[model samples]
Target chain A: MRLGAALRSELSKLFRQRGTYAGFVVVLALVGLLTWGSHYHQDRFKVANELGPDFVVAGKSITALFIARAAMDVAMVILMPVLVAIVVGGLVAGERQSGTLRTLLTRPVRRSTVLLSKLVAGCIYAVAVTLFLGLSSLALGYLVFGWGDLVLFRGGLAILGPQAGLLRLAEGYGLAAAAMCAVGVLALMLSVLFDNPLTAAGLTIAVLLVSGMIEFMPYFEQIRPYLFTTNLPMYRACLKASVDTASISISALYLLGYVSAMVLVALWVFSRRDVTC
Target chain B: MSASSVIETEGLTKHFGHIRAVDGLDLSVHAGAIFVHAGAIFGFLGPNGAGKSTTIRMLTGLLRPTGGEARVLGRPIRDRLRVGRSIGALVDEPAFYPYLTARQNLRLLASLSGGARAEEIQEALKLVGLDQDADRKLHTFSHGMRQRLGIAQALVPRPRLLILDEPASGLDPEGLAEVRDLLRRLSEEGMTIFLSSHLLGEVEQLCTDVGVISHGKLIAQGAVGGLLAGGGPAVRLRVDDARKALSVLADLPNVMAAATGDGSIEVGGERDSAQLNELLVRAGVRVYELRPAHRTLESFYLETMRAGKSNDRPDAEKAENDNDGSG
Candidate 1:
């Protein structure tokens, strides 16, 4: 019961802050930009030239599902991860910098309970931002471009009906949300080590950029599969007409492992460190 | 720990690497009526870096002591689940969600400590004289208002004990008096208040018991009246010819006299006030007023600190002597 109160308090604090809604605003702008950009280039729109020179551009192909999927793909590159980083990075470090952590820690709440509530709140924010991007893109695309079948050219050509494609887009969004949550947890752990929210967020994004860069390094190929960035893009596998359940499950497990390890690290440091701030 | 002691610490030590912020110190604060009409207001007095805040932090479970253990209200300091609920604290500065209103901040803090009813929150706000301004955002508050809100938050939980660090830091004279009266009222209601502050006069008037700390060590701890009365008998005389009076008192055997800033001569050491008055009068110095001087907490604090510093010098000399002999 005490933990429940603390969680409610934590969530209230998180949602009440002005910076918490920044990610949603960024998502709205990105979705709007992507929707308009896709429409402007609809005449020349093609998944890939490698799919075929004969596969001509069709305006009807720019459907709501396709646009939503496109928005996720574009956002996952840097936007969504940074947004999650900013949200979760401030969960603990921001309070510490502002000297509010000392007041909260001195209460009846346990350190572990505080960390857990923040972790859950960060993940909740991650999911919220991701879903907001996905839904906004879909809703705006339907109003502007209309709905139709989705033609995907990832790993070869695959045409999916609107219902099947919407389901696939939903699955992709869910998986993307999970990946962003893993990123949030990673930022949460860094937040425990840093007293500045900007420092933690910047470090998380730097780590993400470095990890993304490492995937292309020939010398790092052996360790590439184990890197978190490799697993973050695993949502793409769900976007395929023939979803690889086993591969998705393995990637989900890796994300879970990373989240659990990060949370444990956060809890250990927060519980043992002195709250002089 | 005594049966009536509300706070007890055994060798409570906290070392920040090379600096010992709080050394091995034992202290006990009893809860019964010792100085006040009821309850007990224990003031932990110290200089800037005297470990007063460090000790209070440990008791509040904000910082973990390196080498000692403490219990508050019968529960170990580490058992925050029980102890935290029973203690209300405002450590260092009053910090809250700047975007949150004062009432909101109190309510949020209240939820953390087993929750508080609406009336309890209102009563706490009213007690701190913040009832009308409780709806204002903390960002708009001045330092004094923030300090009052800090006290209000501590009282919202209605704990058995209050641990405040410099509670009157940013208050004006009126606010200070209000806080003093409020604390006295709380103590009379049988609440144990353990506050750390350097306001000696306030401590002298408000606290029933005081513990003096210096360089992370407890130099003195006892009743305020006892500590003040324990000093040597002294007398203060307002005389027309201050220099002549100083010269006259200097010839006396045991009297140590000096002209105070307020144009009065303070004579320390064992001496009768009437004898000194007559001696000054005989020396052609018109004595305006003469009375037995009462030692202020400020003097007691300074004397205690000086003695503590002098005591450290010998220990350092002995350690140096032992080192030289070994070499």
Candidate 2:
């Protein structure tokens, strides 16, 4: 019951801040711009290849499903994590900086309960952002380019019919949201460690960027599997002609592990901390 | 712990690395009639850096004591959630979300503590005289307004015990008067208030029980009246001839010191007023009035602090004073 009250309070505060809506606006604008750019470039390519079926690109249909899948790729990789980092990173550290955490903690609530409420709130926000990104991109893509079979360039090219493609898109969004939730929890852990929200968010994004760089380096290939960022792009597995259940399960498990470890550490530190400062 | 005590601590100590912020302090505050009057205001007094705030923090469970135990409302201090439910506190300065309005901020806190109704929030605002500006964002509030809003937030839960740390720190004279009146009203309504302040005059006027701490130790804690009757009971004798009366009182064994005041003799010692009057009459000095003179809490506090700074234990000094009176 106390957790529910804390969650409601947290969500109310989150919504009142302009930054929350600003994040949503940024996501929509970026996805819209990406959709327009893809449409314009696809038109140019079609005009350029109008006379030559011999030189045409094979198995690359520009459908609504394809556009949404492409948008999710960018959203999951960059936009989603950054947005979640800003929101979740500010959950604890920002309150501390402003001296509201002292007031909040003085209420008739346990420290662990407050931390859990924030984690739940962050996860809800992550899912909301993911759904918004998916639905908006899908609707905008349909308006611009009609829906059809999805042709994805994975494992030497794979294709899915329109109905199956929609289901895969939903599954892809779910996986991407799970990845974002892991990022949110990691950022929240950093938030509990630091007194400044900006530092927490900056460090979380820095870690992600550095980890992404390391994941692609041939010299660091051996360590790639251990990095949490390695599993973020696994949403692509949902777009395969034959979904890789084992690979998806592995990615989900990796995210869950990261979330559990970070949350446990966060709870431990926050519970033992002296809020007098 | 006594059954009537609302707060009790034994050797409560808090050390911050090398600095001992609060050291081996024992304190007890009784439930109703805190010292002299029912639901009276208890003031925790100390000079700056004297651990008054630190002690308040520990009692409120904001800081953990390193060496001892404390209980509030008959529960251990470590039971924060249970203890917190019965108490409302304003630690240091009031802090709220700058983007949220006063009402919204109170509502948010209320919700976290098991959901205070909207009417309760409004009532709290009215009590603090912030009802007219309840909708204004806190960033736009003056410091005094915010202080009042802080008090309002504390009141929203209708807590049985209210602990305030320098509640009058940022208030002007009018705001100070309003807070004093509000606190008195709350006390009349049967709410226990424990506040800490360096404002001696405010404490003297508003508090019934006071604890004075110096160098991280409680130098004195008692009824405000008892503490103010410093050294021992004395009487101011308004006599026809002040010098003559002083000369006569100087010869008496019970009179500790006697000096002429404004057309009166200010006598200090354990001599009874009746005996002093009889002596003045037998000595042919006409006594107009013989009234007990009480020392101000300010003078007592200053004396205690001075004695503490001179490497003299306050309790020993107080014991010496008590012995002087008995002898």
Candidate 3:
């Protein structure tokens, strides 16, 4: 019941802040542009398929289906972090700065419940915002680019039949949204650790960037599976019909551990913390 | 008094790192009475850094005491939510969300509290005199308005024990009078108000009892009447036949002093002046004037505060002249 109240309060807080809604609009616009560009640069009327159809691309019949499908998957992967940060960065630190939290805690509510509410709300925001971008992009893509064979992108492509392309898009976006939820949780943890929003965002982004860089270094081939960020874009790899699920699943488990540990720390620290200061 | 205790603490101490904010302190607040702790209005009243605020924080479950037992509603004060539900405290300045209007802020608070109703919120706002300004953003309201709003917010929860630490900090004369009246009304309705202020006069008027803390230790605690009327309100009894009357009046326990008043005898500090006059007449002495006399509460306060301060002075250097004390 307490957690339910906190969740309700968090929802009101998320929508009440002008900055949050404004950022949501900007995120939709940016993702919409990316989604539109995937089809705008090329003529979707010209179709090329190895099995049946062919199109002239530089006088050679090329499979542009694979390229457009790759673009959609890439857009989902890239938009997840920045959009997720908007939800994650204000979970705790912003409350501390704003002083409304003092009145909240003075009530008969526990600190753990407050943080728990924030985490659940962060999850909601993450999933909702990511999916909103995905659906907007997909609708815009179809409206402008028209439907084509959805090519699954990893290395070699599996051409999803036109009838199954929308379903494929939904499944791909689901995986992307799930990845962003983990990112949101991670960012929420960072928000709890620091008082300044900008610092929390910088630190979370830095962790992601450093982990991504270290995982890509050729010398550390054995460490890629262990790096959380390496698994971060692993959802994009899910577009392939056949791929190793073991590493991506393991990364998800590791991400869960990191998120749980950070949230627990936030709860523990906040529980006994003297909010008077 | 034992059954009436609402809050009790025995040597409750809290140390933040190496600094002792609240030292070994013992206090008990009786239910249905206004209890005030004086020594911190202009900030120099309480024990210097003894953690009076810390003690209030611990009592409100904002901070866990490092040592000693502190009980509110007869239970330990660790579980903040349970303890918080029973207590409403304005430990320091009222912090509010600047962007929100006073009413909106109260609405959010009421939602967070035990329960919220339109009538309760409006009632609380009216009690604190913030109803007229309820629609104004908190930033536009003056400090006194915010202080009253804080009182309203603290009272909105309808806590069993209202713990207001410096609730009157920013108020002017009219505002202070309003707070005093509100507290008087609340106490009359059986709400135990434990308020702290540096204004001795204000506490003297509002509180039925009081406690003084210095350097994290409670130096004094007693009923305001006892502290004021401790000498039992010196009474003068004039009667003819000085010899027998002085002896007879001295024999009575309540009379602290007996002397001849002109040709008549004088009996002072007789708790029951009427009874003493009756006794003198029954003793076959013609009684003339029989009336109680003493300094006012203000004079008594100044004297007691002076005595309490010089309490540590050498015995020979101390003076106990009732007349000279206030002087």
DockQ leader: 1
Clashing residue pairs for model 2: none
Backbone clash count, each prediction separately: 0, 0, 6
Ranking by DockQ: 1, 2, 3
Residue-level lDDT of model 2, residues A98-118, one tens digit each, is 888988887888889999999
Model 1, which residues run further than 4 Å from truth? Answer: A47-50, A56-59, B29-38, B237-291, B313-327
Q: Please give, for residues B1-327, the per-residue lDDT of candidate 3 as tens digits.
A: 233456677778876554555666776544322233322111113533435677787877667788997776656777567777777767677877666778777777766665668788889999998888888888798889988998898887687778887888979999999999998888777677787776767887777777666545666667777766676556555666777887776576645443422353333443576677777789998977776655334444433443455453332122222213534
Arrange candidates by TM-score, highest first: which order?
A: 1, 2, 3
User: Tens digit of lDDT per residue, candidate 3, span A1-277?
Assistant: 4777677777876766666666468656765555555446544423333233442333221123333344445555445586567557777777766655665777777778888888888888878876776666555666665556665534554656666755655655666777777788778878877777777767777888888889879998898777778767656655665545676677678777766777777777777677654
Worst 10 contiguous positions by lDDT, candidate 2 chain A: A45-54
Candidate 3 docking band: acceptable
lDDT of 1 at A26: 82
Model 3: CA > 4 A from native:
A35-40, A43-80, A217-221, A241-245, B1-3, B29-48, B98-104, B133-142, B199-201, B228-327
Residue B185 of model 1 has an lDDT of 95
* TM-score of every prediction relative to native: 0.90, 0.83, 0.74
Q: In angstroms, how far off is B80's CA in candidate 2?
A: 1.6
For model 3, the interface Cα RMSD in angstroms equals 2.1
Predicted complex 2: CAPRI docking category:
medium
